[model samples]
Target: MLRSTGKHSFTKSTVIFSLVCLLGIALTVDVFWATRSSSSSSVYSSIASNWPREESHVVVLPKAANDTDSEETVDDKANRVPQRLLSATFADIPAPELEWEQMPSAPVPRLDGSAVQIKDLLYVFSGYGTLDYVHSHVDIYNFTDNTWSGRLEAPKDMANSHLGVATDGRYVYVVAGQSGPQCRTPPTSNTFVLDTETEKWERFAPLPAPRYAPATQIWKGRLHVMGGSKENRHTPGTDHWSIAVKDGKAIEKEWRNETPVPRGGPHRACVAVGDELYVIGGQEGDFMPKPGSPNYKCSRRNEVVYGDVYMLDSEMKWTVLAPMPKPNSHIECSWFLWNNSIIIMGGTTEKHPVNKRMILVGEVFRFQLDTKQWSVIGRLPYRVKTTLAAFWDGWMYFTSGQRDRGPDNPQPKKVVREMWRTKLKL
Candidate 1:
């Protein structure tokens, strides 16, 4: 009878142990499902809701475990990165308000300085400093740091002033520009390439001829240099030259003069969009002519500001586009290409020789290439000229340029160190 009792006890103990193990497993699974349900529901709710006003980014959620629908396959998930956040599902997010936001001032005040961006960094090259002082220092602004952390010196032979500048993401090519104690006295053909990674400048073959305020663009792996102030005058020539490159370096010091542009003007702004080069606003006619010069009869003290527009195709052909509504003499200002349109910001008009001051205009004009139309987008807070403009990640940045309050002050201030920027969403 005792033996029978022991067997029964053993069976009972075994049954209890099994029940406890099953109960623990069930509890563990219940906790896991509960946590997952709560977390996934929260994530979906946040993603489904409208994006916050101040939020500029969104975290994409992983696919749900049960999302095995044939229509929404794995390939769809792999292909959609930007669309996942910026698609119509997030349409409630308001477009960025278009306005100029002042960024941190550059370490050194400069005007007529050329600017270029590689990745997240912005580099400002040589320009006119205080009291019309010429500079060869390169000031770099780090977007990550939100500050100018370092400065690099240009090559000793670099003559920078309204010089043609271009970058192929690694090397910055500084082309012919004027450099002298006095403004616009001498132009140099010296070409200097700055390796951004090394912060060092190396000399390249000089331009065929010296050019000041010329427009430069890297098109089809070659440097296309166009109109600018030549020699001792503001005469713009139709010379268009291309410098070939191989393995990220200039192949030769010689420039192959391509088909000349349809027209010539000093200080024209040129930008490359795909295979086409768009040229805009320049000072065409000579402002000052000698007594025996051909243009002496029509030449005035100030060059004629133009609102003309032209496009150069891949075939080396030029096409004239709709002219600007108003002529601008700020020939050195930078222009932005966005949404198949061109945006021209602050630049100066003709100079007042009697007053010895130029009329600085803060007007912003946009050109729609498709419609061949013009519209006034907005205006800068103050009139500035000789400023350089660069676009990166949908933001337009204007670096320090000279600003003359003209008429308000007989002796107007010459330069402004303020850097202004605005969103391109508008």
Candidate 2:
């Protein structure tokens, strides 16, 4: 979150000048940040602070008046300044609009869902049914037939969305996440495993640090979950933990806490390559509960959506890696490895060039493991966030999540059931 400090006196003209500077930053922000950030340990935030606000605020600047007037009297008479207005536009047509492939539609629209591919089937787990309802069923899609073949019920006490899912190509693990609807809710520590071969679900050791959407991965025969929202939901947690597993059962009865991530937050990507574990593209702030609302309505506050990348070696030591071409978030489940590179699909950028709102990213990014470099490889058909992605044979397939309806919709409608695929260029 934007931790602002110190009071400063500003003239009306000075305030106007500051606003102009904020608006022009889009042109220089990349170069300015590049110098301050480096390849192995970069950090950044949405530099723009005058974004949207849930409620209007009164900015009382000191005013000049007759020399005889007291300083206190001038403060009382200062005029209020309306905040920078929100001037957002959208694309004319609906996005992720499907065409004639005749891909089968999912039974329901899901947001923030988790999925794992096993052989010819993709197992899609629980997510919010929409913005209000939570889903507890698992959907199975068969690639051999190109159809959603089956559905299974999840654990009785699993979070409906924001889960951390990892797989060993057979046993899929579902970790902590928020359990229900609304804001300001504590996340669940429940961890469960589903054995695909047997269609059986088993309970496992609970997560040591329950996170809203922690990055979970299986590296060198162990399960690691790291970096997500703490109990407060607004505060990011960097705590990391892991446990040994054999078949589908935990070899270790309890989790072992390891070195923490450099920065912590949800909506980040966790991928394992060789002896290293990498964390990429997450945000530090969240939509928080209002001061005194009856339903605990959430309001967007100051935040840091960053592309800083870090890697953990076999010795648990941290190493910085090249950051993304631009800051990205809401890509926790949308990253996968292909051709010795980590490919990230649609998500959101740090902030909009024209406004304070974070904008959906349409470009596809590739982080090359061999060269340790980042490049914009391609762009999505429609900008999206929290999309479930998988790479199979020569095709890149993705489904679910919110998609832009217009050219650049800031806030897209929640979730789509359509699935689309494109053959990778290789």
Candidate 3:
């Protein structure tokens, strides 16, 4: 109607009212679109995970023996994760290729156990079974057959847990360790060797003194043992000892005193590369059991987890290497030499910088001897300590340790028998 009378029908009040109505409609539409655009952007931001949504997990049920789903370890089409494997924090850096698969559970559950890999067989020595109850049997797993051989009885004098063990391909040499359990028990200097080829046991010259979880490795016709807790379980031992060995027999009658470690403690990862013997991780303090208490109530003292790394060179001199990314302990045997790099996985770390609360670690750390550098390469499904680790073929296998209770409660909770392996490019 205003279009036909546009020139003369316009009153001043009506024109003002029309203009006001038009402004109100425009503001309402603009506000509606602004709110709708904000809502849309929030849901679909730079990262799809920015908004809140129900998380769907790809649950991996414990695989049973004879389950054909083993191939699902890597090829599972149903695998779904809440976010990308690599974090946005990584920027454009390409992460190392890594994939982990849960293998069949170990024959038994134990920590502080000594594991040695032979040609095709894995020999697991005695260790603390349930609450300080030690198992003196050796459980052998044949990687070729994926079967566990019958339990082989260890030497009667062999320490039950915290044994310093090394393999010369066919022979596993057991060094000093705690005899029975923790706390009240004293360490044993008794040494024994098991010949995997002959299925025989032989006694060797003992260490000068006993140690708990001593850093042990075989290199250049010698077995070197260094650094561990003393008999009191709270004292740190820095002494190093070595003896000439040949074909499962001690060529020398006694262990010769060698160089001492810069920092001495137990639960450290020791690996021999060429002429260098590297010792990494371990602790500074230990729990002490009551003097005469029957229950063996241990007191957690000034426990300190450390990342110090020491290398014993061919010159028989001690040198320092790159420390761990974080303070980690209780990874004594959870390490192996892979492609000139020492790969260490899982341990306990100081959760708080001030309070020093211990928390279990689940990361795979690599120390390249050639570059003298440390890098975090991967992560495990869960955090664990004292995992018996060995590199077989191209896979890194680790099994049997105390699963993390939680950060709040750093105490040992569940000792798991689950075995896990990850493929590594050689």
| TM of each candidate vs. truth | 0.69, 0.75, 0.74
- TM-score rank, highest first? 2, 3, 1
Provide C-alpha RMSD values for all models, in order.
24.3, 17.5, 13.0
| lDDT (Cα) of model 2 | 0.78
lDDT of 1 by residue, 223-315 (tens): 888888777657777888998875447887688988887777676677788888888877765444445643233234556667678888888
lDDT of 3 by residue, 48-163 (tens): 65644423222223333343444555423333232333211101112354688888887889877878887777788888787657788898877775667657898888888888
Residue 330, candidate 1: C-alpha displacement in angstroms: 3.1
Per-residue lDDT of 36 in model 2: 48
For each candidate in the order shown, give its overall lDDT on alpha carbons.
0.71, 0.78, 0.78
Best by TM-score: 2
